[model samples]
Target: MNHIILGNSLTDWLIALAVAVAVAAGLDAVKAILLRRIRSLTAQRASRARGVAVAALSSTRLVVLAILGLYAGASLLALPERGQLFAGRAAMAALLVQCAIWGDHGVKSWLASPRAQQAEDPGRATSSAAIGFLVRVLLWAVVALMILDNLGVNITTLVASLGIGGIAVALAVQSILGDLFASLSIVLDKPFVIGDFIIVDNALGTVEHIGLKTTRVRSLGGEQIVFSNAALLKSRIHNLRRMEARRVVFKLAVNHDTPEPVLRALPGLVEAIVSEQPQVRFDRAHFNGMTAPAFSYEVVYFVESADYRVFMDVQQEIYLRIVSMLAEQGVRLALPAQTIHLEGRPAVLPVPLPQDERVAA
Candidate 1:
């Protein structure tokens, strides 16, 4: 080996390099052993602190050791001022990169932590993922800015410029951003979730997907209806799936000529029919007074389920039974009719002649 190289003796350089390598290896080995012990001891009692420490330490161990070793080895040789400065900057950049990696890993682990999972409200997994992604992006952006600053770039102006540009970009995509935020609100607030039957404005459908900018719904007609999340939030949303019971109001009309006793008994009869049906609660039945051609009755009830089909079935059964009972009782259902009355007839009538008689006839 050459005795002298780059103004340092080869032996001395080799010793310094060996010392740096030994120190790095020793540090790494110690970290590994300590981490292993800690993990073993806390395996059943994993806490937030332990999780954070593990995530931060796990990703950048080798890179950090390499950076330390490189700096130590470089210090042993006689290098120009510019070269030393460049080496320092490079080390700083590597450190920043390692920090970014550590932050990313830590964030991901935190997001996937049992505590986070437990803390999340039902149906908020997508919101958590989105939050994690945004945090990571911000973390890397900070890391990049630090790297550029270490490399002698003026970061104050750059930060200002970035802030201004971000505002402009935000304004340009305000609608899309609004929808994205609305989607996050939907996930977190949980007005509705996947498989929920919802009615928005005139559209009725089941929620299928909640995306960043839009919610996709499968309508009753078997077609997809995509609505902007912002607009959906703005509109009134009826989440039928969350209903424990459904209120039903129906009207029945009987012929005006029907006996008053039957009209008085109509409420009791309807209530009995409603009570007999399974999963139904009779609310009230009333003689709603007389219409032009019929005696009107109003019936109110509750179906003890959120299912539309079940409600329809119960209603149909009630209708059929009511018709059958009324028929058995010899009562008549009303039909719409008009009754016109004239107090007097026209005093003079001019009869028209046949078309063949002409004007003179």
Candidate 2:
């Protein structure tokens, strides 16, 4: 047999080939063992951390092992300097790519975690997806820059250009980016959730959908109100759904001529009326004070439910009962009125100058 083949001794070539084969086979065996262990662990206790680690490690095994084997074989071969440099660069690039793949897998696993799903507000899956996409983009961008630098490219200039371009792009889409960030904040902070009744400024509605750039609300008037997420965040928001109970304060006015006994009984009447209603907890009822033309009474109560409809219904029923009770007692609701007096001869004798004018006419 020839002692040299392709400028390398036959013995060296055989040894290098055997080493490469052994490394590849050994890596395959290790991969199988690790996969088996991961499966067993998952079966015993499924956890996000375990899944992420396994996913990251499993995705890159084949590529990493191949690169390592190739590197070992290349080192043994009597190759030219350029060939050696090219092989090294190739291996590095492959490793970088494998690392990016693992990062992607990890990100996906984290997004799918039970904690993330439970803690995130409704529609947070979309936000997680966007975040994963951005992470992957950034990872690949860094990997590309590193690869280019290793290949003798002027990466400093390239990085500077990318920076400038990114700045310009950001400036151009500042509004969109603002809304995007606001959406992310909404998901994280949970200011409100889907089906929540919210009032923003003068607009009142139920949250229907929360998008990346806008939030859709179904208003009381039966139309959809769409506001940019950034602008919506800027407005004062009243999340009615978060209220544990509804407090209601109302006033009642009766004619001042009402009998003193009826006036005294007014508070008890109001309390009784409120107590009779379901979901209502009476606080206080008192003859608060006297107004210009009536005696005023104030009533305070709370509705056990946060539902606006329920509150209104209970209030209406209470009002009806109060009106009925007052009618039965012959008490009348007060209306606005004022009294005028003709003091001292009609307050100037209806302008005495007018008498002179009338006589002349």
TM-score, each model? 0.78, 0.75
lDDT tens digits by residue: candidate 2, 1-361: 4698877888888888888878877877887898789879988999778888888877866767777777778789998899899989888887788888888889888887533663345446555665677787898888888889988999999989989999999999999999989988887787887778999999999998877899999999999999999999999999998999999999998998899998988899889889988888899998988978889998999999998889989988998898899999999999989656676774545545687788998
Q: Write candidate 1's Cα lDDT for 82-103 as tens digits.
A: 8789879987888789878888
Off by over 4 Å in 1: 27-31, 38-58, 61-64, 76-78, 113-122, 184-190, 276-279, 336-361
lDDT of 2: 0.85
Best by TM-score: 1
lDDT of each: 0.85, 0.85
* Model 1 deviation from the true structure expressed as Cα RMSD, one decimal place: 5.4
Q: Candidate 1: give the clashing pairs.
A: none
